[model samples]
Target chain A: MLTAIREKVLAGKRISDEDAMYLFASDDIFTLGALASHVAYRKNGRKAFFIRNRHVNPTNICVNRCKFCAFSRSQGQEGAFELTIDDIIGKLGKGQATKAKGMGKSRSPRSVHVSPHGFSEVHIVGGLHPDWPFEHYRNMLSAIRKRFPKLHIKAFTAVEIDYFSRISGRSLEDVLRALKQSGLGSMPGGGAEIFREEIRNRLCPEKIPGERWLEVMETAHRVGIRTNATMLYGHVEDLADRVDHLSRLRRLQDRTKGFQAFIPLAYHPKNTEIEGSYTSGIDDLKTMAVSRIFLDNFDHVKAYWIMLGEKISQLALLFGADDIDGTIIEEKITHSAGGLSGEKLTAGQLVNLIQKAGKVAVERDSFYKTVRVYP
Target chain B: MITQEDNSRISRKEALSLFKNADLLGLGMWADMARKGLHPEEICTFVVDRNINYTNVCINKCTFCAFWRDADDADAYLLDRETIFGKIEEAIAMGGTQILLQGGLHPNLDISFYVDLLRSVKERFDINVHGFSPPEICYIADASDLTIRETLSILKSAGLDSIPGGGAEILSDRVREVLSPKKIKSSRWLEVMEAAHRLGMRTTATMMFGSIETPEDIITHLDAIRQLQDRTGGFTAFIPWTFQPGNTELEETGRVERTKGRTARTSKLRVQSPATAVEYLRVLAISRIYLDNVDNIQASWVTQGLKTAQVALRFGANDFGSTMIEENVVAAAGVSYAVSTNDIIGAIRTAGFVPAQRDTHYNLLRFF
Candidate 1:
């Protein structure tokens, strides 16, 4: 039965929902991987993609607490923290130093793999501060841009964008346009817990609705800001829900062609309202592979190494993942949720991992530009 | 707590359990971790060897074979010493470090013929002579009216440096009976290999999968090799290649030629399609994780082509099998992927690895 579906996929026909369901339920992982890898090889050939960027989560304060979030907190909670503009610039400067140290660590004297202009992008996404006005968000981007104009600013998830629209009394388009004008280069894929309304209502009812999040992303794309998409899986969702979530992203990609990558974020149930163990490596690989198979129009599929540790991320290359987010200097969102994988990987480590996976390690900038190809 | 540390020990049960239940990606993770632990540096190894099949005449007409010819067939001509010596000379000039000499189990060939051939090759060229799989060794023993140990002793004294692990289609006798009943039984193949190992001769092990075998049968095969390696530690590497039923009797039948189901309990082995690249990598990765005592796992590029073989290096294979200047067995089986030395190095470099040349004993000879 899987052979039949695999033949269809080889023929370039889209697999049906039933085929996906069967694949999810079947124990024949290699067959599904074969199909997914077939699609991936056709799409990208042997090149595996990654980005060289830094992650800056500005604040942890939020108005609404999503059940699966381990990073959010009330304004005065015990562990809540926020950064001022100067503090962020300081960290970005420090991050530059750290990345420099990464490239200069006791290592092979091969050509340096970092971009000529170091730190290609600054990835900024964080909670919605109840008291912070719209200008705080706009000023944050302006300050970062003012300090480092060359760094592409990928900030503000759709949830944050929707929240900004609500608090600032602006249309979604107006909010996106304002941020873009303030040096918001693109959007990050987060806060998209699950697309199904049932799951959304139970877990993150106070957050933007699924339709609203999609609307915000579509508005951002309309304003000429490309973005990435993500799905938080391995929680209260079925196989049909996963397929449905991906299908929604696929439909949007077909319309706007704005999504540069699809990242399947594995749900880490540490210190969250929804209590559970971490998803197994098998589940993580399957989710990544299935997303790659479903989102044919999306150009890249990323295995965010922050959540799925280093080894599994390396293995993910053969299982339909073409991107391992980046050499994230520091990560707090997943860390707060009991994520134990280190906060950062050195530039040399990233190149060695990709190369050892028998893939050409291509260092990419924010818009998926080839920064360096570590062949 | 299997951290990415070197020499982290895992029990056979744990390894087999992973092979049975772990997802393909999970298995790859374990294998890659192991690979990293074993080879912390950025080196992948290959050898430059010419596969010199001395003759094509055979008595064991295995069902999956496409290379054997009848004794009276017009093409069934054995190479004399001069032709063989000229081939070796050409190989030496082309930078070949060894020669992989294998052939069908010819019925009329006596033990003296093999001894003379080995002596002639050694007398001519200063190259490693890795020849004679276990089945071929067993055939020579029976024809010479000697024990397997005696046969290996004679061949070793006559300049056979090591043995290549061929003719190990599937170690499970149940599957072996249906695939190649005329070949040496599973135990005899192992016994020949073990005798060679006891003689302090290193030999590689191989598994020809994707035929009439279940996952359990694969485990069985791996378990056999693992146990033997544990005892002697003489096995240098393990190579797993998919059964290419292209021009063979298996392809002609369109089904397994014997029983539909080998056992009443087991489901019929499907000959509908060959194992895909995914299956090949799965087996390769699992073998690396399982056979901890074995140091190297080679990629069978002749059957899988360059792309999959390149990918296999990441999965588990630390060594590329050979640069077959002339290979007839798999080529006759109709799935040949010819690659030159430059092509191999380019593929390895493009795949982000440094390609080094190794000899039969896996000693690094040069790095390109």
Candidate 2:
């Protein structure tokens, strides 16, 4: 069963949904990893991507309290708070200074800083505050843009975009264009937790449906704003649901070609209403490998270190993941839900992780453009 | 012309170089080839056993061990004969065929204590007693003023079936001096294994890497196992696991001090971060490729978890190790992954191998 799929992948042919399910079910994990590695190599060629990025959550006071989300809190909740534009900018500035100092001390003489701030990306995502206006999000982007013009602002999920459109009484296209004009370079993949409606309804009842999330992404891509896609696995969804989600994303990418990467977010089962344990290492690697093999149109598959932890994320590089996401200075979502990995990884540590896995570490920008390739 | 068999037996220098410079997936493929050459059938084996720690009180306060306790520590315990027998009885109820009886080196418990424990367990349970690692045996011998052979022979007569590969953490004296100053030295570990083999008792060997050991130290550990296995041909398996430094003293201090220039006390070897899954796979593959004489390479799901253990199938591990009805050593270090017999079977079957239940000696008893 795997041999036929292997032949198709090696020959640069697309695999069927059934073939992907077979790969997922089959016990040949090593071959699945090799196949994924082959496909990854064909696209990226031994170059593993990481970005010096900072994740800033503007608020935790979310209107939609998703079952699986330990990050979101109701308005006026004790732990719920929002970040002002100046507060976000101040955080980024302070983070940059601390990172620059650390990098200056530990970075080898051969590896030079690609960005002066020690990072090229600021990843912003947060809850759908009930009172915050669309102008608030637009102002936040423009303020960060005005402060650091060189820093690429890859912000917001499609769910947030959908919320902005509804809250402002505008269309999806108008909302996306407004954010882009406010200096949003790209979108981080979130909110597309799962495409199957049955699981989606149970997981995040008030959040936008998977179709709406895709619509927002397609709208963003059509407006010339490239974004990444994500699927939250190891929860209630089964193999078919996962494959269906990938198929939908691949179909949309075929039309828009907008998803720069596909990230399989491992469901961390802590402080959440969902009753589950952490996804086993096999499930994590198999998801990465299958995503690489099935989502052939997507240029990259990221092993998000925050959810997968450092060790499994490193192993995911060999299991068909070409990107380990980024040096997320402060990741609030996963951490709020009991993330096991450290909040931030130094650029040196990131390089060491990739290089020790026997691959070249390529520092990338928000769009995965090469910033620096460490030898 | 070099034959394929000769090529399979990698030299120590070659093994070290490969460990230093091999690509992760490439090394895995090579190890998979070696695994296929040994176990051509699509079958992976696991033993259903319970690790009954007779006592946690130990005089050898090894720095890396979280399972050891001082004689007066609040949680220190010595299991009674009834408890041990009852545990074995429960294990036999679950179709468990072996009892992994191992514990710390207690100063109070002499040879008579061990002999009686073995005899009592044997008298009750009709099961294989895979008891006593090299360190425990050496301790018993030293406490009883007996030789290693004599100690092992006495234990065997009391129905001790085999020796598990524990306490052989990085078979390098430099590492032992820093990580476990009070534990037996590397030579003594090997000597005990050799003595047990000479007495016609088959045993398993292990190496706990990913601590303070260097690449050279890892290769040295593997080579030592390979050399000993060649001589004795009694090592049924070689299990390599990462050192989980969670609750141990090693994690608290976060540095291994290595004395330099005889009198200099300032120099320190910075402790490395825990081994990543990639490093674990790399070393596992290397162990399988280098240790050609050893038949089984056990994947450590207890440390790496089930998924990585599944991936280990292609990394040259033909054995999924024991069901581990109860494991406290790694758990003491704050990392515990529990798996049932069905879970192991399901994992192996999904990983594309026929899962078989085996005895302590790696003999297949039943196929799932």
Error of 1 at A29 (Å): 1.4
Candidate 1 lDDT score at position B250: 66
DockQ for each candidate?
Answer: 0.02, 0.36
Docking class of 1: incorrect
| Best-matching candidate per lDDT | 2
Candidate 1 lDDT over B19-116, as tens digits, reads: 66665656766687678778877688989888889889887777667777778877886878888888888888989999999887888899999998
Worst 10 residues of 2 chain B by lDDT: B258-267
List per-prediction Cα lDDT, in the order shown: 0.81, 0.86
Scored by TM against the true chain B, the candidates give 0.92, 0.94
Q: Write the per-residue lDDT of candidate 2 for residues A1-375, one digit (tens) a residue.
A: 777898999999999999988988876667888899999999999999898888889999889989999988888778999998889998888655434534456455444433334677898999999999999999999999898888899999998999999999999999999989999999989999998889988998888888888889999999999999999998999999999999999999999999999999989777999957667677888899999999999999999998988888999998899999787877789987878677989887788889878789998888777878999
Interface C-alpha root-mean-square deviation, candidates in order: 13.0, 2.8
Best by TM-score: 2
Task: Report the C-alpha displacement of residue A12, candidate 2, in angstroms.
Answer: 6.0
